[model samples]
Target chain A: MSTTEMTVHAFTRMLERHGADASRWPERQAAERLVVRDAKARQLLEEARGLEDLLRASLPVPNPTAARMRADVRGRLSTGPSQQLIDWFDRGPLWRPLMAALLPLGLGFVLGLGFPEPAADDDLIAAVSLLAFDQGTYLDESLNASVEGGEYAP
Target chain B: MARVQARDSEALEHLMVRHGGALHSYLYRMNPNPSDVDELGQEAFLRVWQHAGRWRPERARFSTWLFRIGHNLCIDRHRKYRWIAPIKTDETVETAEPTSLRRAPDQAFEEEQRRQAVRRAVAELPERQRSALLLCQFHGMSNQQVADILEISLAAVESLLARARRALKEQLVQFINTDQATQ
Candidate 1:
């Protein structure tokens, strides 16, 4: 293990120093210095710099055609129901309708406590009523069966 | 939102015109496919439209927030599905028509090859490291701005970039050395 392995911080400082300005040569020069000091570290920084240069150089210098992008922006900006519809849908999964439904349910719950019970087709309440009837019938049958068996005839 | 809500078409257009190139370039570098770049760029703006009411002038600049949105969308898209392929010199460039700017034939060939190599190296880096490196080195964002965009501590941004740079160097060296050997 070489005692001279530059810490990550040191390498970062080198990047910050040299990479501060795109036009400035010092950042690259500083990076080059660090490369010289530590062979492995230098190797890495050089490769990174090469990659940076490739990016800077390869970037399509001539502005890319933005006709589509411009159309997109313009389409979005134009005052119309389309943007409004998109904005509503982008709110995700009928949030307003869900919220509206919840509000009535919540109001009903609050109203339920004070107002006379109104007749309504509640599946939950109907299921519970049917369950009670079935249980009563089951108990009656069990009692009859027990009497017939003389297990609890007395 | 600030003052540039839906009504701020001029402001929105100004923003798109000013920062669109850099933003497009960032997307292009991250994803080799031009379709993915445009798709993600459009998605990022869609977010801007949805959240227009939430933009705060005091906390961040509009462009800063916009880039942050872009940075997040790219990261999310990468995680959701791996769009970035291995960085290789031989990979074909797609999606973009060649720019009008002409270079000497040999120089253009060499430049294209180098770019493909760099792209592969960048794509191979760990996600955060690659994002941070691109934001700072390629997009010319400051460390502070990069940190803000990435929503990471400055130290974390620096660390990720360092690691990214190291990984790229290793890849570039191997690529160069192998090319030399073959020659």
Candidate 2:
């Protein structure tokens, strides 16, 4: 909206939201005019100006850390995968991470053994024969099956 | 931004040079602890580096996008460390009056008091109010940018700023009165 149409209340609200900086205000001319014509507007502007000044003085100066922050950022960026692992380790207590890692392993192990079925003697013999790379048991099993089917050849 | 998207350190550095001060300042305000400023600021840029490929320049200004990262980090950090006291130690105070204090001791001392009082006042503001004020006042981000960074509505940002300032005006009455008395 144009400055001419702006009221003291609107100007005051604008000052409150955007502060009293005429340059930053959208309706600088209107705000300036309001400040000139309206005494209350002038006072409000003055108060805001004072506040802005105090904030400018009191606000945290980022320059000190800005440079250091840049340097640290560059360093952080330059760090490779191995360094990131070390950095992760540096974040907090070791036991928490250790527990985080171990808890899942423990849970998985318990779940894996939760419903174990007893292996038959034949299954154990088969597993042992396979591990030993013996062809005798396999051949015997194949022959016995062929004989039972009455299809064995001498 | 394209080079940064390609994972170029030089371009990332360039962006940091351009917006690092404002970003650092925003984080410094958001974080109560001064020490976290470095780490948080670094993480903000690091995210820019890692996620530049995700940035859409047509959608938002880089600064807005960058501040949004910083804002999110601030919230997460705040939640992680909810009980942190806002410490305004003299050594941690980075304002200019410290150097000038050697020249005009009395005036500088008074300025220091006001500065600390203002810091205390700002620090004591609720998180969103302080965020709104810093983004708008110091960083020169528009209300929309503030809302975007804060992930709040424009009307909410306006409400936040008014509430923040009203609280400050109340808390700062003593300092204003002190100024008038001095003048």
Candidate 3:
């Protein structure tokens, strides 16, 4: 809107839109300057200015004892990694691939170490061989009888 | 930040000294609860340390990144504890005054009441509007900077600030009118 034609509502909108600082409102500065000359626009700007002042005054300053907060933050920063290690494992990109590769290997190693290979048990080997020998002899006898009968028939 | 990522405590300390106060104040303004403020501040800084490797200066300024951390923490905390007291009754604003000059009891009381009204008006704002107002108006950050921190467009930031200011003006119109009349 043109400066002379700007309404009070429009000026207020401009103030709210661009903020109270004229420098920041480059496009609206000329129009705002003109609007400021009008009584209604001036009143709106004044009220808006007052609100800005209150808003500024309302801001709580940095607590001086916030140094304690700084110290507390530092303390946590010192100890932060251990607590965050799990987070790192879960979210860290490198850790993800590293864990993905290492997990199965680590599990296999643990299982291998936890349960050692039993020393070669002669008794167990002998029992297995005896069973194998008996099955082999039974198969041999059946095959030989089938071969002899086939020879006689043929 | 690279040093922090490298696990340099001194670099982390330097960063904390530089930005911790501002971060704490931002959190306090957002929630005004001391415990929440402290916890969120610590959490934000902690995240900063943890995610130091993720920072890319080309993407955002360090302060913007840091404040984003704090802002996210505030959102998470607010979401988790919806029943926590709002920022309306924060007494920290009273202590924020200069202690060097003592005001009369009645004068201090009136000032406290005014501050309380302003806080309530601000705290009652919607999340984005409140955050926009806090970052832009109170923190003196540019609208573009606020947009970066809040991950909104410049127009959205301006709209948010505009709405927030308009709402604050409406809420405290009586006080603003009186103050102007007195002046």
**Best candidate, TM-score-wise?**
2
Across residues A1-154, which tens digit of lDDT does each residue of candidate 1 receive? 2334555466656664345342533345444455677777655454445556545654443344456786776776564887666655443344554665689899988988987555655766898999999999999999999889999856
Question: CA lDDT of each candidate?
Answer: 0.65, 0.78, 0.77
Q: All predictions: root-mean-square deviation over Cα?
A: 9.5, 11.0, 10.0
* Candidate 3 residue lDDT tens string, B104-143: 9997787778878988888789999989888866677888
**Could you give candidate 3's fraction of true interface contacts?**
0.50
Please list the residue runs of candidate 2 whose C-alpha ends up more than 4 Å from where it truly belongs after superposition. A1-5, A65-71, A78-114, A117-154, B92-94, B97-108, B180-183
Q: Estimate each model's TM-score.
A: 0.59, 0.76, 0.71
Candidate 3: pairs in clash: none
Off by over 4 Å in 1: A1-13, A16-51, A58-62, A78-154, B1-3, B79-82, B85-113, B174-183
Order the numbered candidates by DockQ, best leading: 2, 3, 1
Off by over 4 Å in 3: A1-9, A62-66, A80-82, A85-154, B88-107
- Alpha carbon lDDT at B111, candidate 2: 74
Q: What's the lDDT for candidate 2? A: 0.78
Using DockQ as the measure, the top candidate is: 2
**Model 2 over residues A1-154: C-alpha lDDT tens digits?**
4625668889878888888767678788778877788899877777777777778767756354556777887888778999877655544344446766898999999998996575787799889878776677778889899999889656
Model 1 lDDT per residue over B2-120, tens place: 44586675666666677787888777766646666777777677677668888888877777888898887777666556566554343343424457766689866865776666666
Candidate 2: tens digits of C-alpha lDDT, residues B1-183? 899988788888888888887787778766756678777778888888878889898878899999999888777667655664574554755555455446477876777778778888888899899889988888888888888878889899999998998889888977766655665
How far off is each candidate at the interface, as Cα RMSD in Å?
5.1, 3.6, 4.2
